[model samples]
Target: MPSISQLRKEEQALHALLFTQAQYKNYIPVKSDSLLQIAEAYYRTSSDSLHKAWTLFYLAQYYRDSDEKEKALSYFQQANIASRNIENNQFKFLLNLHWANLLSDEDAENKGIEKYQTANKYAILLKDTLKQIDLYGQWGWCCLLTGKYDCADSLFNMGLKLSTSSKMTYYNYLLNCLSLTARERKDYKRALELVNRSLSLAKDSTELYPLWNNKGEILLEMNQYDSAHFYLSKDTRDYDPYFKATHYLNWSIYEEKIKNLPKALEY
Candidate 1:
């Protein structure tokens, strides 16, 4: 059996998807700082082409997750170059996926969707279930962002159904996303129910924090001011870049609801 890196051109694309799957599972930036340093030194000295490309991509991802966007972008480009001789599209797809995410968050939704859809074709060719499901979930969020609520619902439900055998964490996330659709529909009661169900499924506080924030947002939409404040206040912990942005966004909205206009602006 061939390793992903040694697989044929099309199958080698699985390398990027596999790397992405393992990202959420083993990512620990602070703890791996020294390890990364050692890895970098080894990469600098190593003569193996395969190791060089792999290390480049890993460093790119590390820098990306650490919020060092310039370095991440540089390394991603370098990694692509390092692997240019390989008969595989994994490197290109990996770069495109990250670029798509950045584009989506920066308001270039159509460009982002194009990249994501292009990558989805590779995922489908590989029969990568998790990647397929993740695309649906992410694409659904993009739709949600564009106020296509019904389309978002269809995509998210398809993702949720596909992920039935996945981890509880993913299941809860889909539930949380579904509640977002409900919240957007102004079905506050349904939103509350969906979020509460996610809370019940959460294994720990790390999982609960986002749901608390979501619940708070739903309560605010329902005009339950005090209860909204209660849940929102529970999520005081600083989160990763994406979640931190969401935290501030909800906080801003909560402040706006309470008529604290100045404070809302501050967030």
Candidate 2:
């Protein structure tokens, strides 16, 4: 409930905190202590009704990606509380979307789908088409995860078309979603084609991580082990090492295909 000037200052501080946090995010062993310091800084300085809400959203996503589900959920709730205090429908929708996706337990898929729908509606009302497409993509993935292939396919198609149209900015997201849909359909050739398109577009942006990962996955599915290895190896060392586990898993399958049981086992 601070004045507009106070709100602007709080928003600026939150933005600065996000900028600093981005520097350490690509590392697998992300410095959690550093992240905690940033969160604490924001908590101390945030005075506006919405600033803390926005800050919590980013913190929740960071924890979610770091595999700290409990912490993620806690911040997500805090974000909701802050958003409610400000009557900020946009932030509320966004926070709900995040909380929905983070609740990935088997029992949570239905609730997640419901929240995604609600978020999508609010995003549309706000004339935030880009976020709507992104939400659709996330919702599609949720459907896919829940074994609702038809629903997932429909949602992805909508998102892809929207992204490919006027908002050509998010074309990479569209391509990635298409690749995911193709993979789900077992259309390895189409998946490879989609990933190739993504890589071409990603070369012009900072979204190289998804480009490399999708290409490697498609090559792995195509049984192109050596080629897959080359793609994965080209990724920056700062990229998560857990993805290396995927490379090894694909190599194991390749060894099996070549009738090298011992090598496969070793892999």
Using TM-score as the measure, which candidate wins?
A: 2
Give per-model TM-scores.
Answer: 0.64, 0.69
Model 1 TM-score, all chains together: 0.64
Query: On residues 154-214, what C-alpha lDDT tens digit does candidate 2 reach at each position?
Result: 8888887888776566777667777877887889888888878877777543587767766
Flag clash pairs in model 2: none
In candidate 2, which residue ranges exceed 4 Å CA deviation?
Answer: 1-30, 33-47, 55-59, 62-66, 105-107, 189-238
lDDT of 1 by residue, 83-192 (tens): 67765455556555666675676677888788787767767666777887887888788888889889888888888887886652477888899999999999988999
lDDT of 1 at 174: 83
Collision count for each candidate, in order: 0, 0
Task: For model 1, state the Cα shift of residue 171 in Å.
Answer: 1.5
Model 2 Cα shift for residue 130 (angstroms): 1.5
Q: What TM-score would you give candidate 2 relative to the actual structure?
A: 0.69
Error of 2 at 256 (Å): 1.5
